[model samples]
Target chain A: MTRIGRVWRKSVDGRTAALYLLPSIILFSVFVFYPMFRTIYLSFFLTDQTGNAAIMVGFENFVYLLGSSEFQNSMKATGLFVLYTVPITIILALFFALLANEKLKGIGFFRTMYSSTMGISVAASSVIWLFMFNPSIGMFNRLLGVLNLPQIQWLLDPEWALLSVSISTIWMNIGFSFLILLGGLQNIDEHLYESSRIDGAGYFYRLRRITLPMLSPTLFFIITISLINAFQTFGQIDILTKGGPSQSTNLIVYSIYREAFINYQFGTASAQAVILFLIILIVTILQFKLGERKVHYQ
Target chain B: MKKLLTSSLFWVLILAFAVLTACTNSDSKEKNEPTKNDTSSETEGTKDDGAATGEKVSIEFWHAMSGTGQESIDAIVKGFNESQDKYEVKAEFQGSYEESLTKLRGVGGTKDAPAITQVFEVGTKYMIDSGYIEPMQKFIDEDNYDLSQLEENILNYYRVDGELYSMPFNSSTPVMIYNKDAFKEAGLDPEKAPETFAEVIDAAAKLKTDEMYGFSMLTYGWFFEQLVATQGGLYVNEDNGRSGDATESLFNGPEGLNVFRFLDTMNKAGTFGNFGTNWDDIRSAFATGKVAMYMDSSAGVAGAINNAPFEVGVAYIPHADEVQRNGVVIGGASLWMSKGIAEEEQEAAWEFMKYMTTPEVQAKWHLDTGYFAINPAAYDEQNVKDKWAEFPQFKVTVDQLQDTIPGLATQGALISVFPESRQQIVTALEELYQGKDPQEVLDKAAEGTNRAMEIANKTKQ
Candidate 1:
């Protein structure tokens, strides 16, 4: 009787666990998993005007994308974008975090100011940046004129467009990264610093020896998140450039949107999406495999 | 105690995930539930009211008009509702033309679709091929509506196979708008704007100043299409896809090459200002005197004249150096009735469309918004005449349209993949500005269009 009662209790616990998970399970299926599967499925077919899968084209879409110069340009742009935004954002955010971590008067004010950009939505900031990047009436050109420097067509020139977009993206991302890094900086044990000070070690020495190693876990997390965010950037590109100036700013995600929404070529768009998914997956897996070893979790 | 703590922490994490997903899901749920509830309750309420009095058929009209256009449309709808007691038309402002068309796709060919939708001129082929629309010809035939009263130039673009698929509403065409101050400063006659490519190039060279470029055109595909059409050039084979299915792009031919070379000449001479793709940016540049002259939509002429500190002159878009001008194709949107709606609902939509075409309403629309009046008699309206006298630049746009030669080229292309082809043209123009060889870039764009068309053709059911 006791064994039977224990068995019944275990089964009840299992049932209750599943019942508790039902909501999230349903949500995940609806929002994330279903769309993901649909994207993969749609990659194998061509869609008609209404975006309905009309004919099965096998892997022709993928083959075409691989051979197409436009898609190749998109891939290169996305790669360069990721490279341009991630490291700068991480490094800049770290510098700000370190500065704001010091125990001094008005540090809270500095901290708030550093993280202020996190509050502004992507679309709003992009519009503001768009005005600033305008050729004739923008502040940047006026400043250049004042300095007796030749004007740069910040968003219009193909040579400068991608770099300009990257600069704005870096500025937009620094706030969130700064806040997270600051949190991590605050969480570091005070005794380690105290002991270092007692040992007659300088600030740089302590930073190199204790602070960095202790902050490694947080740094790792932030890097991973920033990398993913940079890879998935779409809003600023859409607002500022619309992937123009000879397709110089046509990032893969923006290209996907143009293909899907603007052109209504859902099959090729899905193929692009699938490729993006694979790229992100491989990058994340590589990050885990290689980067995790260096992170020291306390 | 430790085990209990761990178990509690696990539960808390699970609860947090549930809450997060719920928050995201609830937004869409909340949006959907209210609309469903309102529709059901409104129908019931209307049904109950109908039982007591005579039934009023309420139909939805999805339009892509905003700002002044929206206000004018709403006024017209209100007047229509008051004019009659049997039908009520509800006009909903969907976003831009592209966005509204996207939303329409979800409810198209279904009972939930709006009774009427306003689709852009470029979407004509797509809408006809989609099988989601009831051709305006049907309603016109049933009611014996007078089509001859409408503007022939505007009607030419929408009439496919001698049948009108949609009712032409707000129509516009491209015109060259220049600053009279700049033209006079350059010793060029402001009153006599350049009429051909070579003359415009010469004028542009003279107009170039230290601060302002000589010429500019917004890097839009519509303007490119207008340039090609004005030279009596077909965009696609098979009579610009009017006679049959267009199998190849013809824009890479000599006519398109002339446009490219014309721009390339100015670009190489450092007389052309590339204002990117946005209309506002280019217009602002013109307003600020960054560029002396530029191509602008007929619809934008009023605003340009109103906003510019200098006197603005509007003229027909220039043609190739050697060719006679063929004038501009009609751009803008038209009203279409849905096929799947109830017969009475479609009838109400048709009645609303007819009401929209009346001279009084069209005159108001033309005056309130810069879009051309579809009913040509609207120009004879006292208010339009008064307004035209006040702003004579508006007269140039009207004259340009009336002077257009009716042909397959000016009728516009009839391919379902127009948006994609336009994108190709945009990219081609962008490449041209970047100093690429004109023929190479144009050919590349044509090839891209061909691929898109091939895929579209293959996938057609």
Candidate 2:
């Protein structure tokens, strides 16, 4: 009781600190926290045409989503999308980062080129990809025609839609990951590499032992961000396929948008959103618990 | 320390109050500013008009027209503003039909809503049930307006329970646009386009070649609904949802199955071009000769005629072999007035709508964009006749509309959940192209629509 009282007294003494945090608290409550709580509240009820909660069907929205084939398809698509995009994007970005980190002639140009895709907005890039994926006169099909090969329906076939979206997503994401990893690579101590070289360690051996461990913190951060980003992907899916070819590319975020905005079924949309939030929360928590041990802060 | 804590708490509360008040004050200002400007403009108009006593009511019109349609609308609005000094109609392009409707929901049933909004044909039921609209019949009755001057088939889609809910504007129907050059190259009659599903399939097989597929349709729900409607098929129960609330989807009947099977057979025969769900993709494919025949909006006929290297032929959308063609439901948007706005503003909206239906304006609209003039008398105008003489394909669309049988099927289905149901149909079409069973996919789509309708009914306040 004494300790608790002392803690309370200590907090009261830090009223100045509370004043400092008031602005952020107010902003967050208005923009983020309020909407998040409203979404949770709305998840349990059906909305009318005006989007007001009109019917109370507690947990029915969540129950319906669990049993819905479309929602299940969305989950599967999101999982496969994460699987397809994250690793390939990380490794490819890492490769580009390593190459650009070296001291070579016009290396500055190379770094800029590697990170150029980050300059393009997702909507613009997705539009460009949409044209390239066109079945008739697209670059891909024309190239295939030139090679006398059977053309692939890049965005049309049910089998290829998700993969096609993931391919564009990976391309769009690589630049940011590459830039960050390059910054981390540049921040590593030069003396450590010099000492390793003096020890007669080969380049690959040093890369495996020194560079990776040194880059682990950056890698961990990128991985967590990329995982969350893949789950929330909407623009590319909307522009490229629009969850078409039999809903193959209907990622969770796009499905939520369709339900809430297009269908005006806010209850189901909010339930799906809540499920997505929990999944991301669990994934992030697991990452911090299990993956953080491998991260080298120094 | 206690004094510091108390002072800090007071400061914190003051800051929070300031932020909250600022947000609310700005919101109210935004809502009030338009009406303030409108009132000032009205007083100015009264001073100008002198004895007329007409208060200048400026009403915003939200439309989804783009490209040439937007250009035409701007010209028409300019004409309306200049023709009358009493009402000033400001036309604003608000993205696509779906997007604009979504925006309307934010301000719907409130004074903040636009006085006039152009909602698509599928949104007819939704707008009527939305409680945001003032039915056009009320205005027609008050003004003793002649509603018979408008095209009955076009007005039929907007009339609910024998009362016109909205003023029909920029109406269109689906037409099968074909490449005449491709037809000749395939040794088929260039002028005689396929009229039935079986004939279309046969034509498609012959039209198939190394460079082009025989047939294609933009996998859109509107085209599917048109195809089903032409077979005299009810999209939902209860007289196509015109009599009472729809409880089930009737689109999975034999009529829908036939249409799906038609596409399925063509797809299996490698004659159907799958251009995904984009309108531009399929349109471009048709223009580039990648597909010989495809379903397109009647309004798109002019563009096809201009863009395609080959001669374009426009015909009625095909129907199943066993069923006589029952014509098409209207597919374009209509102008709706808001109920909550000031009476003078509603009066302005009505005046604008009346001006829109004038033969001169409708003629210009039809010539500028290929959408059918809501007032059929616009066809008698010299400019439309001159344009039609140069390009007769426009006449086919008009004839098709005039020939439509006035029945519940062609009047279009009434359901607030039309957009959701259309999405279900789109998915079913995509699956059918993926080699899924025709009946199975059709039934699945029906079930989806049924569930949506049920939920909509249950949640209706």
Number of the top DockQ candidate? 1
lDDT of 1 by residue, B90-171 (tens): 8887777887888889899999999999999989988999999999998899899989999999999999999999999999
Query: lDDT tens digits, residues B180-247, model 2?
Result: 99899889999999999999999999999988999999999999989999999999999999999999
**Candidate 2, A42-81: lDDT as tens digits:** 9999988888899999999999999999999999999999
Clashes of each: 0, 0
Q: List the residue pairs that clash in candidate 2.
A: none
Each predicted complex: what DockQ?
0.46, 0.33
Q: What is the lDDT of every predicted structure here?
A: 0.88, 0.88
Query: Which regions of candidate 1 are displaced past 4 Å?
Result: A1-17, B1-53
